[model samples]
Target chain A: MDTTSTHGASPGAARAALLVLADGRFPAGGHAHSGGAEAAVKAGRIREATDLAAFCRGRLHTSGLTSAALAAAAAAGADPLALDEAADARTPSPALRATARKLGRQLMRAARAAWPCDALDALAAARPRGAHQPVVLGVTARAAGLGPEDAAHCVAYESVGGPATAVVRLLGLDPFEATAVLARLAPELDQVARRAAEAGRRALTEGPGTLPAASAPLLDITAQAHAAWPVRLFAS
Target chain B: MHLDHSHDTTTAVSADAARPDGTRRALRIGLGGPVGSGKTATVAALCRALRDTFSIAVVTNDIYTREDAEFLLRNAVLPPERIQAVETGACPHTAIRDDISANLEAVEDLEDAVGPLDLILVESGGDNLTATFSKGLVDAQVFVIDVAGGDDIPRKGGPGVTTADLLVVNKTDLAPYVGSDLGRMARDAQDQRGELPVAFTSLTSGEGVKPVADWVRARLAAWSA
Candidate 1:
């Protein structure tokens, strides 16, 4: 699965652009969050590398796929406001909703500075409190001259990558082992991204209703519970 | 729904001279130091000392919990609305130095919520000697180290020790017990920092936090002028 096929005429330059956007060190405030891993760790669900892999795999199929589809739709030039409402409909927990919007606002600040697009400006103006993060991610990808598939990959990777890094700190799981878990899941990540992009392409014809609606109940419940915590590590 | 163009349309990215409405934003000063160096205590003292003259707010970057924020709140240093706690996800330095998106959001949110403020103190979680505030996050920074941590900290200068706008050597009251040499530490700091300022303090003393508070007032005056 060669995911790094440069989209533009200048293949090398386009490839480099993808690298910059997708790099974990992009400094978009993803480091402070554990993508539900912190909750799982607190619950004693993830103890070692294997448990982490299983947890990540489950999240990848659910929240990961959903975020990927929304991102792909945004990259394909869908309406961000409509997608934002769709995001709200999917996210049941108020805490998760707040987290999504907060992260979205922070991401918008960084993206606007990097890409400097009128569309992003318009979106930022439209949702001053911030839109859903996946919607913003897709729009940012579009601003960077990337396509739906690239946006899908970006969200999908972040789905597992965030948890992996966080689990390293939370559980002291071997960094090598956590990274290996991601490496092992690369093939599945590719599949999820492709399906998300396909769904995104369909969204233009049908509507945002065509996008995937996958949810993990435990994750949602735990996220709400975690927000009430007086003391916790990750923000979400 | 269009955002109030006057409030939200800030075009300048880095720590700008003015808010989007073209009014001068509050002067932001960051306090960073090693663990147990009394950065929070200093912040509390500063708030108690300067709140009468300035509309003050605080943002604390804590690694795990909201301990620092809770400390200020419990002490009643400022009203609850004037305080914000940012979670750094165990990477204290990242929030202050490397990727400052979270800290920027906190500061801006505080300003938007409590407008027309005069000063905002951004307190970093206790970190290593290398941690310093990014120019984008704060206009100036103070590095705090205590004699108990080691009088040798100044001699082994890192970015925070050598480059901060103000370096505070705290807990001079414990110098004798800790076998720390205040004079030698000052000399080493001078040798390392060449014209930057340093202050020795013991929070228990009446005038302990006075120098740092006065320094902040001077910065605020300069910022206003």
Candidate 2:
């Protein structure tokens, strides 16, 4: 029952910390971004809950899986700088890469305040511009005493959750329907998290190059187009 | 694993007094009000008035576009590099109050790009009466409302009107044309804010931003002291 001994507790006891990190309102600057939902919505690809579901499903399996794997690897103690490079390689659009790093720097700021670990500080100092959000998320999980699975789950959930929330705003879709979309995706989300965590575990020994490289070409192309728009609701 | 020591990064966390390099950071002042309330105009005027006296920069939170930042740049109040624009995803209040990460990054980037700044004005996008800047984001806040918006806005007080460090009633020149009673607004504002100060301005006239500029100068004096 000693409060000072809490750090020594098992990851099972750190469920609250995981929730804190994974919460949509973590103040890590994710609110300003639509996770490509804006671009898809503008292109008439996400007009309703069904389209949103399909879009999120596609994203979750491709870029989402890749990001989850990168996060998991970082959480499993893979080199963050290398993971950052891998994230850059996976992202074809320069615009998405900038968004990822911007979000990463913001996440680093919040994580340093929330956890205050040397590892997070080192990453922040090393990449003053930013180090890719998935990498930062993994390192943040490690700092918060969570494991690779927890980090992967966070990335996997965020992959769809961000778009679903954004579509509700852009299309004014039913909030309940949006919630249901995420509810339906929960099973796939778990699978993605498990696969990502497995890859992350392998990455701990094989290096960050071993992480998954799922890609969504349409998202990359549309992101570049979205960035050039003179007026848009989301940053990326 | 909790590390006891402070972070070694150069980025200052929120309103930290000193930069990590052991130099004093600039004092941040936030400006918030409803749309068309002259928040950007006041920011531009403040920069013009104070730029000669002190190193200054601006961080503008625009709801969707870079209009505010562009306005400042077009006026040439401060150099292009001294201005930064942050997108708020249609929630200016959230960027200024709830989730201030983007705005914080803007301020930190400004300081890094142009350091030794004496002041940085954080301007919130035109929002509702309830919007207010977080204490962590700025040392003080100014809530601006135009006489044209309605003199009754003072009586219909919200967080911005009641708790802001300073309340500015702008566009006094339009009061007669709009049929807004300046005296009533002044009295109601006094009632809403017991001892807090208020400034009435008409930026169309020469030296109209003087009152707000004086208030900022006083705040800077106290911050430097």
Tens-place lDDT per residue, model 1, A1-236, is 11222233221124556678889878788888999999999999999999999999999999999999999988888888999988898888899899999989888888878877777888887887789999999888887777888889999999999999999999889999999999999999999999999998788788999899999999999999998899988898
* Chain A TM-scores in order: 0.94, 0.96
What is the two-chain DockQ of model 2?
Answer: 0.48
Q: Which stretches of candidate 1 lie over 4 Å from their true place?
A: A1-13, B1-3, B6-12
Q: What is the C-alpha lDDT of each candidate?
A: 0.89, 0.90
Instruction: Show the colliding residue pairs in model 1.
Output: none
- Cα deviation of A116 in candidate 1 (Å)? 0.3
Positional deviation of residue A22's Cα in model 2 after best superposition, in angstroms: 1.0
Which residue pairs collide, candidate 2? none
For A2-82, candidate 2 gives per-residue lDDT tens digits of 111225644325789999999988999998999999999988998999999999999999999999999988887788999
DockQ of each: 0.59, 0.48
